[model samples]
Target: MKIIVIGATGRVGAQVVTKLASDKENEVFAGARTPENVPNASNVKAFKIDLHDTKDTILSELPDADALIFTAGSGGKDLLQVDLNGAVKVMIEAAKKGIDRFVMLSSRDSLTPDSFSGPNPSPLANYLIAKHFADLWLIKATNFDYTILQPTALTEKPGSGKVTLGSYSSNENSISNVAAVLAAIVQDDSTIGKIIEMSDGDMAVDDALKNLI
Candidate 1:
């Protein structure tokens, strides 16, 4: 399988790239705004993909890929542009290019009122609003095989190699564990059309996702 991982320079995205590339059967391409910034790996190739680019340009840069894993973000800035608009644009291009599978890295509570944890107008609110719409667009506006992973606040701590899926009590997840789930789902057809909410837990990553609805 040929997969393109957007935001490959990011913490979670880099892990996804490395994990997928380690598989001999899968060809992974790391996509970033500045391709040079992506970590070097023998099995992974880096390419430039600006979400804000023209549709044609974006499509041209993206090879004929079997799936697209989007973990891009603007780091609390340009939520509307990079988070919402950029994501929608990539979805559209994926449709045009016949890329069937899409895996979105979203946040927990993005679709619920609880997303706005703070006051009415907070940065977290804006971020959740952007992700909410992006996830909605993927579900309602496209026919692609899509899996949305809504994990809580990400941490750099070593993964427990375990996770809780579907629901969780807190909004905290290790980046490695989240990446493990993403790598698992990228090749698991059963996960198609599923929206999974995740956090650190005692269940192994594969076992947790196997029970997804």
Candidate 2:
């Protein structure tokens, strides 16, 4: 399958690219704002994608792909630009391109802003607001299959190869587990059009996906 991964330089995006590229049957088109940060792989082709112009960027790179994986987002002041507006742009372009399936990497509760942590989540958490808006828009948009994976706080520890998949968000997921789940979903046909929330648990990734479906 031909798949395009946005934010290929990011923590979870990078790991997904690595796994996809290692598989001979999969072709990975990895995009990052900085080309140098995108990892090298025999099957992965890296390119620079400006989040500010996500529609054009994706239109230029994704026509040939069967799926698009959206992991791109900004945390600082640019979060609104890159996460909310940029995300909607990408999804819109994907619909125009007739892309078969699209996957989004989102934060836990991003779709339900009222459930956000703290009476005053930092301004930085505005990123979550943007993500929530994007997710809501996608839920209401037309064309193309979609999957939204909402995971809790990300960590850098090596993956435990375990996770819990459900419809509700929680604070228990690890970055490692999230990455593993993303990679698994990229290859799993059953997860299309589903919104899966992930958290750390003793269940294997395959088992998690199974239970999720």
Candidate 1, lDDT over the whole model: 0.89
Q: Which candidate is the best by TM-score?
A: 1
What is the lDDT, from 0 to 100, of the residue 89 in candidate 1? 90
- Candidate with maximal lDDT: 1
The list of candidate 1 runs beyond 4 A from truth reads: 117-123
**Alpha-carbon local distance difference test for all models:** 0.89, 0.79
The digit string of per-residue lDDT tens for model 2 on 43-141 reads 888877787875766678654688889888675558778888888888887787777788889977787666655786645467777888899888887
Candidate 2: list runs displaced more than 4 Å: 116-125, 167-172
Instruction: Give TM per candidate.
Output: 0.94, 0.89
As a whole number from 0 to 100, the lDDT of residue 59 in candidate 2 is 74
Task: For residues 35-148, write the lDDT of model 1, one tens digit per residue.
Answer: 898867777889999988988888888878899999999988789989999999999998898999999999987778664764554458889899999999999999989999
Q: Which 10-residue window in model 1 sums to the lowest lDDT?
A: 114-123
